[model samples]
Target: MKGEKMMKQNQQDTPLYTGLTRFSQQHPISFHVPGHKNGAIFPELAKNTFRDILSIDMTELTGLDDLHAPTGIIAEAEQLAAAFFAADRTFFLVGGSTVGNLAMILAVCSAGERIIVQRNSHKSIINGLELCGAVPVFIAPEYDQTAGRYTQPSLDTLRQALRKYPDAKGIVLTYPDYFGKAYKMEQMIQLAHTYDIPVLVDEAHGVHFSLGNPFPPSAARLGADMVVQSAHKMAPAMTMTAYLHITGKLVAKDRVAHYLQMLQSSSPSYPLMASLDIARSFLATFSQQDKDKVMTSVKQVRACFGQGNAWQLLPATKLDDPLKLTLHIKQGYTGFQVARYFEQSGIYPELATNTQVLFIHGLQPFGELEQLDNAIKHVNDQLKFVEKHATIEVVNQFPQKLDTLAIPYQQMHLHDIVHVSLHQAVDKVAAEAITPYPPGIPLIMMGERVTVEHIKQIKHLIKQGATFQHPDIINSICIFADE
Candidate 1:
C-alpha cells in the first residue's frame, strides 16, 4: 500500500526505479540473500566506482516489491511495460528469455500434452519441453541453402503440423529467428487460432520489432497468446534482462506468473528488474526521427560493403528485419576468418558460422556504424579478393529417415542419460541435446537416435573448428542407454 501510494504520487516517473530510489533513501540495514550486504562485504567493490550500483542492489524488502508476487512497484513497472508493448500483462525476467520460454511452456500445457514446435528452436525451448514433460511435434524451419541458415517456418508447415496434431495444446514459434528472418506471423497466428490453438512465440532476437522499426511486426502485436523477448539482446538493457508478455483469453496470467516464480530465482536481481523498467522507458520515448537516424546509419554501413567486394551483405528482404546485418563470405576467406579479423581489429560480431558473419544493430540506443565502417575498411585492406577455380560441389547424402531412439509417447527427461563415444553412440537415443553454439539449434535432440550422418556432421564441424558446447571431451555423446 505504501509502495502503491509512492507510485501514485510519482505517476509520471518510472515506477520500479522510483520505488528503488525511495527505498535507498531509507538506508535500511542489511541481512539478505546477497552476501555482499549492499557491497559492504566486498572491500574491492566498496570503492567509489562500484558504490553507485552496489548501493541500490537491494532485495525485496518493505515497499521495494516482490517479482514473484508483484503487488506494488514491481506490479506497476509490469503495467507500464504491458502498455508499452500492448500486452494484457508483462512480467520482468532476470533469467533471460530462456526462463521466459520455460514458463510459457509450463504454463500453457500440462504434463504429457503435445505442442507443435519448430525444429530450429533454441535449446531453451527444448529444455522447456523437458521441464514441462511436453511432447514436441517438430516441424522443420525453412532452410536457406545459400546462406547456410534456417529461416522462419512457413504457414503451410504450421497448418500441416496442426492438422496432424489436432489435439495439440499449443504451438511454439521462434520468430524473427537468430538472423532476424520473421515469417508471416500474423497469418500464422490467425491460422493457429482458427484451430483453437494458442500461439507461444520465442521472440528472443526480436524485442526491437515492436519499436518503430521497418522490420515486420512482433508476434505479440499479432495475436500471440504468449511472447517472450530478450530485451538485453537488442535493447539498452543489462544482459539476462528480459520480458514475458501474456495476452488473449487462452493463457491464464496467474499460471504463467506462478510458473515464472518456480522457474526464476526466489531472490530475483533488483538491478535486472530496474534495467527492464529503464529499457521500457527508453523504448517508450523513442520517436520516428530516432528511427530514421538509426536506419540511415544502418544503410551507410550496408553501402560500405556492396557488390564487387570480397564479402557480400545479405540483402534485407521484406520478411527480414533490417537491423540484422548478415555478411556471406564469398572468396579468399571463411566466416570464421572474417570474424577473427574483426575481433583482432577490436570489433566483435554477434555470431559467425562457417558461411556467414552476423552484425546486429538498430535495437540498441546507438548504432556502431563508425566502427563497422572502419572494420570493413580494415578487413578490405588486409585481405585480397582472389578468384578461385571452380570445383565440383559434393552433394551430401543425408539419411532420409534417420531412426530415433525414443518414440513420441516416450517421456525423455534431461537427467535420464549416459555418455558414450560418438561411434558407439550410433543407434542409441540421445540422453542430452548436442547443439552448436552460434545457432544453438540441436544437431541431435534428446531422445532422438544418433545416426551415422549426425556423427559425420559433428566430425565435419569439429574439423572446420566449429564451437560445440561439450567439445572438450571429443567423440563422446550423451545418449539414453537401452532400458
Candidate 2:
C-alpha cells in the first residue's frame, strides 16, 4: 500500500506539461515555424479565444524535444506514460488512434500477408489494411442482444481463424464495443499467442479501463502485444491525442517506432502532447473515492430516467462500463428524433442509433441531474406531438462467421471504379467503404462484394434517418466496373 501511494505521488508530476508551461512563460519570440508567432499574428476576432492555447502550440525548441527522436522532456513524459499504463514502452500519438492502427499493421505485416481482423472494427482498421496492402481474414463479432449491438467475436470463431491461418502475421481486434460492452479479451489474447500470432488491439474507447473495477480491463493490461488508445476519448485531453503501447515481446518495439515516425507528421503539436501528459497523470492519480463519486452521480442520473416512462436504460452486464449509458427509446420513436429533442433542450448525447441513444459520462461526477431531468420532460412533452414510428428491431446484419474481401487490397486499383445506383450494385464489388459515423464501423469494406443483404441494410438505415459517413451512399455507391 505504501509503494502504491508513492507511485501515485510520483505520477502527480507532469513533465511535458510543466516544461511547456515554463517555456511559454519565457515568451520566446517568433523565428520559428507556425506563423502565429505565439498567438501574436492571430486574427483579431478569434484572438481572445485562441491566444492562450496558441502560446503553447509551439514547435521543437531547446528543452521541448522532438517527438520522433525523443531524448528530453518528451522521453520523460512517454516513459511516465508507459509506467502508468504498465507497458514495455509507450509512444505519444498526435494523429489520434488512426495513425497507431496504421503503424501497428504496417510494422507487422508485409504486402499480401494475411492478417486476421474483426469484421465490426472501426473504418480506420480497414484503411490501415488498405495502406499496408495486407490481405484480411475477417471474423464476425457476435451480436449482443442485451446491448443491442455487435460486441466481440466468439472464442470459437477466433480459434477457427487461427487454425485456418496459423501463418497469419497478427490478429487485430476492437476490445470494447462502441457502447462500452466488453468480452473475454484476455482469453482471446491467450488463444492468439498460443499460435505465435501477435494480437493488436484498437482499444480506442477503453483508455480509462485501466482505472480498474467498475471499468472493464484494458487490452494493454490483458497481455495484448500492441494496444492503441485515444486518450481524448475518455480522458480530459485535447482531441487527436492518443497513446500506442508496446506491451508484449511478440512485436518489435523499434519497428513500431519506425512506422510511427514514417506515418506521423514531422511537426507535432506541443499542446496536444502536453495534454497527453496531463491525461496520464489524471488516470494515475484517479482515486477510489473519485470512482465511487462518479458511479454515485451516474446512478442518480439513471434513477431519474428510470422513474419516467420515456426511456429504458440498458441493463448493465458485469463487464459493461458504467460511464456508457445506453437508453432505449420506449415510445416507439427513433433515437435520432429523441436525440434531436434533447439537443433542443440543450442536452447533447454522445451518439444516437435507430433505437438507442448513448451517453458518455466522464471520470468526474455527473453534475447536471436537474438539467437532465428537465431534458427528459422536454423530450416526453415534445414526443407527444410527433408522429410515432415503429420501433426498429435489432438484427444480426453480418451473419457470416468468417468472410474475406472479394478483391484483395493490392488488387483494388486494377479494376475501374464507377458510381452505380443501389439497384445495379448487387453482386458487384465495393470500391469504397460505406461506414456509419460516430461509431465509424464500416458496413461494407472497399474490397468486399456488395450483396443484396448489404443493400437492404443500407436502405433500412437510410430510411431510419441514420447518418452515414459518406452521404452519397443514399444516391449511389462506388463499385468496381464490370470486369
| Tens-digit lDDT track of model 2 for 13-100 | 8999999999999989889889999999988999999988999999998989999999999999999999899898999999999999
Q: Give the clash count for model 1.
A: 1
Point out where model 1 deviates above 4 Å. Answer: 1-12, 31-33, 145-148, 362-371, 381-418, 471-473
In order of listing, the candidates' clash counts read 1, 0
Model 2 has a clash total of 0
Task: For model 2, state the Cα shift of residue 167 in Å.
Answer: 0.7
Q: What lDDT is obtained when candidate 2 is compared to the true structure? A: 0.89
Clashing pairs in 2: none
After superposing candidate 2 on the true structure, give the runs of residues whose Cα lies further than 4 Å from its correct spot.
1-5, 308-310, 392-394
Cα RMSD of predicted structure 2: 1.4
Model 2 error, position 193 (Å): 0.7
Candidate lDDT (C-alpha), each = 0.79, 0.89
